[model samples]
Target: MTSPTDPAARQLLAQGRLEVEGRLVDASNVTLYCALELDGLSGHAVYKPVSGERPLWDFPHGTLAGREVATYLLSEASGLGSVPPTALREGPLGVGMVQLWVDTTDDELVDVRPPAEVPDGWRVVLHAHDRLGEPAVLTHADHPGVRDLAILDIIANNTDRKGGHVLAGTDGRVYGVDHGICLHSEPKLRTVLWGWIGEPLPSDAVEKLRALPEKIYGSLGEELSAHLNGVEIGAVVERAEKLLSTGVFPEPGDDWRAIPWPLF
Candidate 1:
């Protein structure tokens, strides 16, 4: 099968036959690991049935599957983040989100380590004491893709960018997943990728952000309307514009939580 980033992989995700292999027990909602086949091509994917979603007080308007697909669409349109090939479709359980699975490597991107033992080139995010009274620091690699994902989270208004959601794939790409709690028309952007706060946006990122508003107002807007409300769509454009005007990474807002709990 082709790499999940390829267009063919997206088509396969949108139109495929799935066989559930197991469940991801740690997920708050039902997450099934499945083996999927389409037109003689085979691959693995994660399927989340809408029927299994646990309602949240804050995000009570739509199914989590919609948010997942919407986030993927935004990432695709902006070319800022590496989101897997995701689609909403009928699965073995019911209608849900099906995303091509990424085979990740043992790469440690975001991590908590003893301050003295932190990698030489890693950017430190926070300095705190570990549970055992040991001095630990939160840090991440100064990688271009990781920074792109951080900026993507800002535009998408991602509310839950956990450390574990950042993956280093075997294909030599960085991916951000589990975007069920994103694109809210609110300023709730919790994430672990805040090491570049106050830094100027990369030249390439500035160009992409400038290009995003157009797509979000045109073809991308039509596609996103299926999952996001009009206000939510407008918020995305506004977020991009704000970032472009500022031309720098933002610090966490005081109105909401900054980083996800249990970072890893």
Candidate 2:
């Protein structure tokens, strides 16, 4: 199978024939690895149906697919382009989200090392002990792309930013996925990218935050309203405003668990 061009991929995701090839095992919710065909073009995509969503105490039931699309819209509007093109469409399972699959064949691991052994240029988030009771530290590469991801997570109010969610594309760019639990009305920003907490927001990130409110009210807000409630949309705008006002990365709060379970 050949990779589709950007425009063709977008068209396929938005309006294509989704054929479920198999299930992605061990996911918290039902996820399918599928083939998307449109106008003789074929490519791979991930499908997650609303009917398959597991109930969550914190989020409204069956809204995960919408949130996934919302994140893609927000990414495009914010000009971050870190999220892959995604759309809400009807698949074999039902109305679900279909996102163009990212190529991870050449991806590299974001290394985790003990604090004492960590090399230069790696940012440490916290210290802990391994299963064998040896000291270990959670770390991510201190790069601009990772920093951009940290900013994106903050704006999205992502509550499940696991380390595995960060992917490095073969094109030498980083991407984020699995945004079903993001953009909550409450402050639920749990993530592993706390490398720059309490630091000034990069100028580009700050500029994006300042312009996000405007972007939201336009097409992005309209698209999100279909999946998110008024309160949640308001909260998203509020979060953007707050970030712009503070002009700094936020520290993990003591009140809530700031890390996702099973860190990877």
Candidate 3:
């Protein structure tokens, strides 16, 4: 239910007092759950401090939190609106990524089920066997917001778009989270959103792509300069252009593994 675009929500996230409530133990980096409040506006948030980020062999050290914020910026600029409101700020641990926490529903947007059991209206991304050698299929709901996330992932060059990162919020919004490994200059798009392969880009998606250059050269480009280098920012524009030129959902390439390991 966190609406960061609202004036009050923006003010609360930027100036609210933060109190650590708990920690997400399964997170690779130190992820803290916090309660934030300012002028009676209160909500929960997640804080990931750069000091606690685990070093990755592929990505630059201590830059994950900034990438998270940058990804949110691109998502907003693209009119995807599938990413939660994320910001970079000082927390109890240190400077890090802070995002408004989404209250999710029980709806399972993505799932691995027997091929015959794929739900009606769902899109199947892959057909494979499970650990028990049972026929399984990776499927996701065919929702407009989910498609928005797919387009966002393409432009962001998201390296890890696992099933768990797709959240169906109680507010009837679909959100993509945990964008610490995105917006790279290189081609490392790993995602579970290939269900729309070769299909024409939705009208809304095309319009957003058309308008991206104007926003990119304006405030969006200036803000991203803090997190990404000139080359990386330019790469995003290139990806958008490619996607627009193709006018269709992109196909996975052979150079890298298309789907992330342990899809969920």
Give the range where candidate 3 is weakest over 10 consecutive residues by summed lDDT. 1-10
- Cα RMSD (Å) between model 1 and the true structure? 0.9
> TM-score winner among the candidates?
1
User: Among these predicted structures, which one has the highest lDDT?
Assistant: 1
What does each candidate score in C-alpha RMSD? 0.9, 1.8, 1.3
Residue 226, candidate 1: how far off, in angstroms?
0.5
Residue pairs with backbone overlap in model 1: none
Candidate 1 per-residue lDDT over residues 86-200, each given as its tens digit: 9999999999999999999999999999988988888899999988999999999898889999999999999898889999989888999999999999899999999999999
Candidate 2 error regions (>4 Å): 1-5, 105-109
Deviation in Å, model 2, residue 114 alpha carbon: 2.6
Ranking by TM-score: 1, 3, 2
For model 2, residues 74-133, the per-residue Cα lDDT tens digits are 887886538878899888989998888888645443556777888678888988988888
Determine the backbone clash count of candidate 3.
0
Which stretch of 10 consecutive residues in model 2 shows the poorest summed lDDT?
Answer: 1-10
Q: Give the runs in model 1 whose Cα sits over 4 Å from its true position.
A: none
Question: Each prediction's TM-score against the native?
Answer: 0.98, 0.94, 0.97
Flag the better candidate by lDDT, 2 or 3. 3
Residue 105 local lDDT, model 2: 46
